[model samples]
Target chain A: MELFEEQGFEKTSAVQIAQRARVTTRTFFRYFPDKEEVLLADADADAVKETLVQHLLQKPDVTDTLQAVTRTLADFDWEKLGPRQILRQRDAMIASDPRLLERELIKQQQLTDALRDVLCRRGTAPDIAELAANTGSQVFRTAYRKWLEDNNDGDLTTITENVMSLLAAIMARGPVPATAARLP
Target chain B: MELFEEQGFEKTSAVQIAQRARVTTRTFFRYFPDKEEVLLADADADAVKETLVQHLLQKPDVTDTLQAVTRTLADFDWEKLGPRQILRQRDAMIASDPRLLERELIKQQQLTDALRDVLCRRGTAPDIAELAANTGSQVFRTAYRKWLEDNNDGDLTTITENVMSLLAAIMARGPVPATAARLP
Candidate 1:
């Protein structure tokens, strides 16, 4: 992350990265096939998804299920991660190529599908479950982006709560009057 | 869409599509550079974004501004689009390669950023705007997905309204109690 941030991802090579971390190029390759894997690693991604699913399943109420998922997400140890590590990694991925962004998005879609499946099993309508899953994941993502920007001080729970409130407010406003609206 | 569905995106050629549509190959090329553009032609995408921005600007209340954006999205002309047409495009894009999906996601991100900018301009904090934009888009997307699956029936406005309610319910529940007894 440091190397990518200071020197830019394109200019920095695996050899330099390995030397900076006091590791052999061979060791780096053994873990990550390419530079992109450093950011794309889903090692803990599955674990987090599993935790959310388990938490959601434990609550019978649909609302309670969402709350449980949010709570489990909030308890994640972002503080333990080295400062600037994630931001730098994000900068590198988004800067280096568009492909990384796509991979990240596909991963998000996968998570949504997994969550939707969980909701479906819990007896929610298929379409409603799909909507809930997508909305729930979006809440988590909104909170995560804020949490990322706050130098780790922001509580994920609070951010998630705020996102949910914002969604509710938007819903309460209902549809715009159709007669005056121009269809896009 | 028919050509792609009958065969596949990779197998279907521009010549074939042009022939099927009873249009000259010249006409096809004039509209789309490749076979992919048939699906990628987001003629209304920018217009929709612009309309949302304009609506947001017209509103004095920040909450009203966000709601206006959602309402604008719900008014999309999904009815005019053939269900098979959309499904074929989606299947082809998902099956062919990751690049197509990435491009779509980038487009979505652009929309989210635009929504965030509108909120920020309306006096909401930058972080809060970012959160609102993300959540707002999520609600829009969830409702749209449901609308699409149901053959685009049931007023989109109603679905959007329901999605917003769901978001609120999720948010109102908030995080699970930290000191509560653990789930069985």
Candidate 2:
């Protein structure tokens, strides 16, 4: 991270990262394929998929897919990922470049697909699984953004709950039409 | 459209497209700088941005940003875009190529940014506006997928409304915890 902050993500090499950690270049390769992997590829998508599906499967009696989906998101232990300040800095670094952002988006799309497939394997209907996966990913993304604040010490679980709660609150309040521009 | 459908988006040449259309290459350049623009550039982002902003501006009394955002989306006239079969074909063409999908996602991101800017201009808090824009875009994406079915004759406006309503309904039901896999 220090090297990335100093020389930018593009300029930094995986060997330099490994050297700093007093490890062999081969060791670094074993863990992450490249320097980009160090920052953005830390999250194990397969583990996340398993965790989410397991949560949904545990509650077979709960027929509402969306509810189970959001709960699965809210139940994840986000603090284990890393410190909030470090994560925020990482996010800022990724956001600085369009290519990096595109890569991140592609990763997100893959995660959505993984979740969708897991839901299908668990016997959820295809259409419902698709919706659940997309919506669940959005909920996690929204909460993760909320979780990245400097003063905000909220963990992933609480933040996820809060986001879902906000969705519910806004839905009940409904759309306000008066503020929209009316043509003369 | 016929040329692209027959030869694929990448394989077809602009000269061939122009010749097939009974127009000179010069005329084709005048209308669209390239052939890919023929498929990917139909939905003018500027026009969509203006429409969305105007809708939000007209109703100064509507304080709910999400409501205004979704309503602005629902206000788009879908039928004017052309017949369902043609639109479906276009979507399929785009879906077949990863580059086309990336372009589409980038366009969606731009729309989200446009909405966020419009909401901030309307006195909504910056954070709230950002959230509203992201959420609103998701609503549109989900509804648009549903609207693309071959036998589904549902208009975009109704589909958008139905998606938003479903969100409200799901939120009312709350999350179901038992179906989730046990942490143990």
Candidate 3:
């Protein structure tokens, strides 16, 4: 991460990273399949997903799957992942490189799919489950970004609730009366 | 796409694809930087994004940005992209390959960012723009998947409307009354 931040992700090599860490290239490869994974690696992503899914599954009432999904995520101890500054740098690094960005997105999509499946298993309608899972992820993403950007460690739950309310507000405004006529 | 479907994406080579197309590898590279692009390429995605942004800009009312974003997408002549079966097959192919799936997601995120930027340019609050763009995109994605699966080529507009209403319903249901107690 230090090398990537200093010289850019594309220019940095796995061998160089290995050298910096005083390890064999083979050992580095064992830990990360590629240089992109070096920064994006979350050995615990699957575990985190499972923990969140289990949390959602245990909810006494998941009739409101959007709220259920959002709370499941927003309520997690994100600080346990790392300090806010480190996570922010990692995010910026991913954002700066399209390859890393794509990998990050696939990881996100996988998490969303897992949440949707959990919702389906909990008896939510498939369509509603899909919308709730995807929308909730988006809401949390916005809140997470805001939390990272805050100089003071922001309360993620409050940020998440505010983001959710923003979504609700936009949907509540409803469509313009004339837009229907504009459809082809 | 035919080659990929027949032999799988990873198993196929650019040389083989070029051979099948009766073109030199040079010619193939001239058109697509890689085999992944062969199936995932949207030569017109940028143009489409620009067109959608322009439509949103021209909206008589931009206050309802979510509706504006979704309607712009739902109203487009998606049929012009290709037949339903071809599009479905392409979608399936992308889904089966993590590499292609990641690329597709990046493309989707880029479109969402473009829409969000347009909304911001139109004076919507930044947070609201992010939520509306991302949420609206999610709604349309579910609707689109449904549209592709329908044998009769279901109406995109109606499907998009239904999906949007599902989101509205979930949000309107409000959070589960007791979930707050569960939050740490």
Candidate 4:
């Protein structure tokens, strides 16, 4: 993150990064094939999928299945890292370039797909599974955004609950139907 | 799409594309900075938002607002590109690599944000706006997937309606609260 901020991600050389960390270029190469890998180091879509699936399997009810998945996600702790390091790395990666952003977005999509698969396995109607996964992901995202803003205060579980409630209200209200006459 | 399929996006030289398309490289550059641009083209986020806003303003009731937005979205017709070309391009882009897939996700995210903004502008609560937009996008995506599979026969309006009904049912059978039970 420091290197990326000092000199652009495109400009920062692997050799320079190794030198700064007092490691050999060979050692750096062993850890990451390219500099971009450093930004994408936290890519763990499979692990998340596994966690969600395990939780879903334990719950038979469809709604319980979703709640279990949400609960599992809320339990994740990205706090082991020093707060300063986490913020710096996040900012550097997202603000650096389009490529990094694209990679991050792809990882998120993979996570969403995994969630959808879990829903399907739980016997949700195919279309319902797709909608549930998509809706669940959006709620998770909103909760994450809130958590990031004030990580010191609210728990992820609480924020997620609020998001879920809000989603329920919106669903109850529902979108306007097409058969309803259109306004001029 | 043909250029990308015939020659890899990276390997296909700009000069070759211009020659094959019977246009100067300058003209190609004017339209797209790179070959990747051809696959990434879609409805402008701002235009879609503007259209939704216009639709919302026409509606007298909050219930009609989302329906209006769905109607506007359904009415959109991609300029003269046959169904086959659309399907091929969509499949090729997503299948080619993760990068393109990421861009597609980001594009969808942008659309969601625009929809949320439009909803908020039309007097919906902030949380409701966000939830509505997320749900609406999910509906649109489900409908689109079905439409694509069925050779794009169904209108977006019908797809949106199906999705909305699904969401309503899910909420009617609301899941147990996540906070109801504490971790043992």
lDDT by residue for model 2 (B1-184), tens: 5567778878999898767656679866765657876754444556766776777778765567667777787777655555666566556655654545555666677778888888888787675676677877777777777787736466677667666766554444565332311111
State each candidate's clash count. 0, 24, 0, 0
i-RMS for every candidate (Å) is 9.5, 9.4, 7.0, 7.9
TM-score of chain A of 2: 0.64
> How do these models rank on TM-score, best leading?
3, 2, 4, 1
Write candidate 2's Cα lDDT for A80-158 as tens digits. Answer: 5556665665576556545446556766776677767767777876655676677667766877887777364666676
Where does candidate 4 stray beyond 4 Å?
A1-46, A57-65, A80-97, A175-184, B1-71, B78-85, B88-92, B176-184
Name the TM-score of candidate 3. Answer: 0.78
On TM-score, the leading prediction is: 3
lDDT of 1 by residue, B1-184 (tens): 5567678788999998778656689866765568786744454456666766776666656656456567656765654444544644453444344444555676687788887887888787665576567766777877766665555356778877777765555444554333312101
Candidate 1 local accuracy as lDDT? 0.62
Cα lDDT tens digits for candidate 4, B81-111: 3354455455454544454466576767677
CA lDDT, candidate 2, residue A162: 64
| Docking level of model 2 | incorrect
lDDT, residue B55, candidate 1: 68
TM-score of every model versus the real structure = 0.64, 0.69, 0.78, 0.67
Docking class of 1: incorrect
Candidate DockQ values, in order, are 0.21, 0.14, 0.34, 0.24
- Model 4's alpha-carbon lDDT is 0.61
Model 1 chain B is weakest, by summed lDDT over 10 consecutive residues, at B175-184
